[model samples]
Target: MIQVLFVVLFGAVAIWFAYKVFTTASMMRSALALLFSMTAVGAMFLALQAEFLGVLQIMMMASEMVVMALFMIMYMMNPGGLAAMEMTHQKRLSIAVAVVAGLLAVGAALFGGWPLATEAVAAPAGQTRELGLEIMERSMLVFETAGVTILVAMIATTALAIRRPA
Candidate 1:
């Protein structure tokens, strides 16, 4: 019904944006396409009723993509990728790898021995809360590491932006 249609629409938009990501020569455009694709994926998660995941996906991807684009613009040889240059290397090999990966995913989808649900089961009242707690407890160190990494990156960016004496 509505859920299915929304999922399909989001999936299609994601795929289209993903295609645009690889096809564009402009680095900024590629980043934007990736952002759109990720946003569509977040929308898909929302349509699938995973509210926590949906919000997390959208927020995380948006920030990450913006930061990535900023770095590319600030540091790369071509700041804006305005010149006509090939963005990707080893085109044939990249295509082969992509094809193989797609085939593997399709194979897993078709043949993976996933169990079918025998009956409808209600979600727990505290399912999201419990899941959040479990993730935080198990990955507290990982989160701290990521936070430190981000802090370092921010410092580095700031330092690089500062004007140095000749």
Candidate 2:
């Protein structure tokens, strides 16, 4: 009962944040809302006992997403301000196409049947901490590579965005 309630509440909050991310006029607000949504998703993963995935999601996706958004804002010279300029485009056909696509998707989902996996997806032997140790031991090179990649990407991104007169 409690778990279900938590799931429902968190799901609702995630949806709310997603809506804010899409409709909010402020770019910073949208970014913050996305962060909030991601945090909620991490919470959901934790509640489901996917502690490793939960932590990985936060570390690998949530933090990086926020950093990317911040860099984009900085590079565009927007700073902390939201872009309030209206985007002018043809919406009528797009709206119709989106509506039809949504309906088709819903209908397909309603009728589609997926076979359940016979074996339970196994959790790590000792949950998150044990998994972390295993990752450090066996996959240290992969982890270091990912970290180095992120560092290089951040430096390159910053260097490319900041122009100087020579």
Candidate 3:
């Protein structure tokens, strides 16, 4: 089916980009790879018919990556890592850990006993609107706190950037 094909393609692309993110020497390339990997995850979500989550994933990652790149450009001497340098540390240990973690994740996915709805589900006319309402009603305080925290961090960053060298 088309859904299965899309899911497989997106999953492969996501894994490849994730690998590039960790292995690429260039920091900018790594960030871009991460962005692509996250986007691929959004595509997978779309394939699974989770439109809200898919769009959220894409938008959130795009903004987060932009902020990350700005910070890297502002602070890092060589944001691109053009010079020959080892990007990763503890190579063997990292590989071992990654393999073990991956296997554990696979095992959990294959064996996890997820609860299933007993009755047939009725499709909502406006799933996104319903989700938005639910989130606003249940988690508005958490969202407001996160927004305020981000605003404070932005103000702090602006102050630091404008500070004269002393």
**Model 2: CA > 4 A from native:** 76-84, 88-110, 117-166
Which scores higher on lDDT, 1 or 3? 1
| Per-model TM-score on C-alpha atoms | 0.74, 0.61, 0.77
Question: Candidate 2: worst 10 consecutive residues by lDDT?
Answer: 79-88
- Candidate 3 has an lDDT of 0.85
lDDT of each: 0.87, 0.77, 0.85
Question: What RMSD does model 1 have?
Answer: 3.8
Report how far off residue 72 is in candidate 2 (Å): 4.1
* Candidate 2 vs. true structure, TM-score: 0.61
| lDDT of predicted model 2 | 0.77
lDDT of 2 by residue, 3-79 (tens): 78888888898889977886776677778888888888887887766877877776766777789678668765454
For model 3, how does the per-residue alpha-carbon lDDT over 12-128 read when each residue is reduced to its tens digit?
Answer: 999999989878777788888989999999999888778878988999998999788777777876777778775558989988998999999999988998787676433443668
Ranking by TM-score: 3, 1, 2
- Cα misplacement distance, residue 23 of candidate 2 (Å): 0.7
Q: What is the lDDT of residue 124 in candidate 1?
A: 42
